[model samples]
Target: MHERQDVRTILNRTTNTVASIRFHLILVAILAFPLISGCQNLKPLPDGLSLQGGEFPSSEVAFIADTSWIDENGQRQVEQALFDDLFRIIDKAQEVIVLDMFLYNDFQGPVPETTRPLAGELTNALIDKKKQQPDMLIVVITDPVNELYGGLQSPYFEQLEQAGIRVVVTDLRKLHDSNAVYSFFWRLLFKPFGNSAANTLPNPIGAGCVSIRSYLELLNFKANHRKVLIADHGSTYVGFVSSANPHDGSSAHRNAAIRFTGEAVADLLQSENAVLELSGHAPVEIDIPRDHVNATTSVQVVTEGKIEDVVLAEINRAAVGDKLDLMMFYLSDREVIAALKQAHERGAKLRLLLDPNKDAFGREKNGIPNRPVAHELTAAGIPIRWCSSMGEQCHSKMLLAQDDTGRNVIVTGSANFTRRNLDDYNLETDVVVRGHHSDSVFVAAHEYFEESWKNTDDRIYSLPYERYEDRSFWRRRLYRFMEWSGISTF
Candidate 1:
């Protein structure tokens, strides 16, 4: 009888304690509801409006394209013009080389391949540069996804480090998480316990699956998407800003870049200082060559939202009889859409080449941002063409505009036309080249857009949007939600 009474007493006390704790938690949540709701109000970072993008020197520019396709003979052929330019710069660097690229890996996953050993080639180029100039400062900056959010080992980065190159992985934790809902739970449950566990699970991104712990960490989904190479060109500084990654899986994608030598070379170094300093590197002493204004083209290296502003300014300046062209991997920015629509309404001829957003590394995508945007544009009477992406992306961010005054402008570099990419969320760079219509880059810009749209030379580059048209109501809602809520992976 005595033992039974004691057991009853203990049970009652335990129940009371749990109830008390639960009541307190509920009260706390109620009291903190406003703060939780206001979590989306993240403080903004320093945007590029105040940043400096220098003037054009007496410099020359190059138009580089890497095209992959099935030829008339049904054989895989790739016309690589970017890598040659990259290696050419690496080979001639006399002082320092600062490279900030988003992806560098051999993780082909389930994507198609080219014969090119892209990752190895880039690693070798950097290593060779270091060997040639033993004291030259060579630094590399990349994203954490390349580490699979702490899953697989990065042999490429390790090789660079071993060769005395400084490699800094951007501290993602320092950046704001755009997905507020996932971020709330992540902060409460996942981040503190160490999301990366033992290496027993399969790496979802590697060619041959490797060890990992969780795929949950990857759901966070932000990246350092800038691709920049700044090195010495003769006695002056040269900059290469592009949409290309050294990832082997992406070797076959149609990509473009701009190489320029001028005062903007120092500006490129200055702009990258934000990334390097954010990643905990020391300050850089940019020994820039004096300005000798290049008459060929007026070049400026713009970063972040400044790219968006410049692109819009150039397009919006179009009068009747002008032309506006765009080719990009993803297109969902509302501002850009509005500008394109306005340009079309104002009688500027518009052509857009966009990815179908359909396939990614063996997995199918629902065509989030692009499809709905495409549908909207098509309804607005804008002509759109979808890239015939074999197993990769139409990973190019370019816009060519010819104003009424005959000023030809092309915006080309690493930025994709997305909210996350251009709105200060990711580090990005692009060179704005303004020249005469006869300039080489200006001419090539128009020709590239035309070739992709027309398929003139008995080659298939793009398909009509009707073939991949997605007009589902729910998908449009989902895309808008993802794009506006900052929960997208673009």
Candidate 2:
């Protein structure tokens, strides 16, 4: 009886201790929850403006189709025409130029005699223009992902800042859902510790007029993904619905961007200012044109989560009673597929070029069955091909369509054809350029598509190993694992 009483006392005391610990933990969590929530809701203000400058003249703008290439010396060059256009604009900047990009890199040569890198020349030209006109306002807005993914803290960003340019860095964690989760936990365990680390991470530019701000619209993940560069001389809009940052590596990535001139420039500037205000930046007065300027063409700007069903409607319109040439990085949207099929039944001749690694779903490893959209299209008798391994993956989002009457259109931008891209995730920016000039544009894009298609193998329908070489034990194991993941998109 005595031993039993002693055991009961010890057991009761231990239970009481555990209960106290649990209660304390709950209390701590309750207190921390508000802090975490507050951080997640960080809204600095100015709602969609990131920089300050006067609105550009809508009539003087022109749209351009930009290209990427590697020079003979192996330096990546973003379209030469783009650089030339920038030079012209910087020279004429009367008040301000606001530039926002996801990536920016300048490849200065080791020897003074070597021709300046594209970035270097552009930066120098801007600096010279600033020297000629001391009061010219210049502001640069860059995504914080540059700190991790690209070589951002280089001489380019530094030189721009040192030359009296105002630069703002968007809090990247607030832009994407995945980063929000990581940043929340990161701040929880290390509060001030993390802040200090961030401070010491090297600003390269000596931190001139730099501010960190949060974006509420971006928190939803379907916010702004459009890429625009605006200046007072003339504005240009280069839209790609992909991951081509304005950095050097992206200059080599297979991508497409369009430039605009005339009245379309004002619309692009307005959209860019909207993002800036959303990021808590000051707004500039914009001049809206009353009539279409230059050789007028119809252009539609489509953003995710804003329209009821513009994407589907556009696809349906383009695919119906037309010959379609599409170059896609990812294509998993079911409605798009249905519409394409319907179009085929309606007598549209379709040709497709898709990245083999990125199936209709996403990346496939080992021999796992991918949700290959190409297989379905091929079965339906659409002429579809995969890009070759030696070439860079076909990452451009383009749609070229022509009707029986020869009315042609080209839709290009940062948006992919995936469901997440079309409906949920912030992925693309597409502009439908329609006019008499579209025939030439469609022909150029079609030629590129045909070249890529001819180089790829047509047996992507077969299982991974059935068309490839012998696999190791681990490869076989990985294949089984992926097969069981139940994640194929097709």
Candidate 1 lDDT trough over 10 residues, lowest sum: 43-52
| Global lDDT of each candidate | 0.80, 0.50
Residue lDDT tens for model 2, 1-490: 9999999999999999999999998898777765674545454422332222222222221333343333445443433344455556567676677666654553211212122245566568767867877888777766644432232355676787888876665543343232344345445654333221233233332232121221211222333344455665444322222234454333334566554444455555665655556567765565644354444345555544322155455456654566787777666566777777777876778877665553211223332221245555666777665543322334577777767667666666666765445652342345556654344445565565554445323212112212323335554454334323312221
Candidate 1, after superposition: displacement of residue 120 in Å? 0.6
Among all candidates shown, the one with the greatest TM-score: 1
Report how far off residue 331 is in candidate 1 (Å): 0.6
The TM-score between candidate 2 and the true structure equals 0.65
> Which whole-number lDDT from 0 to 100 does residue 204 have in model 1?
76
Stretches > 4 Å off in candidate 2: 1-94, 105-122, 149-155, 172-225, 234-244, 294-296, 306-308, 318-320, 358-371, 389-391, 424-428, 437-490
lDDT of 1 by residue, 157-238 (tens): 9999999999988766555565656665565556776644345666777743433334665666667788999997777788
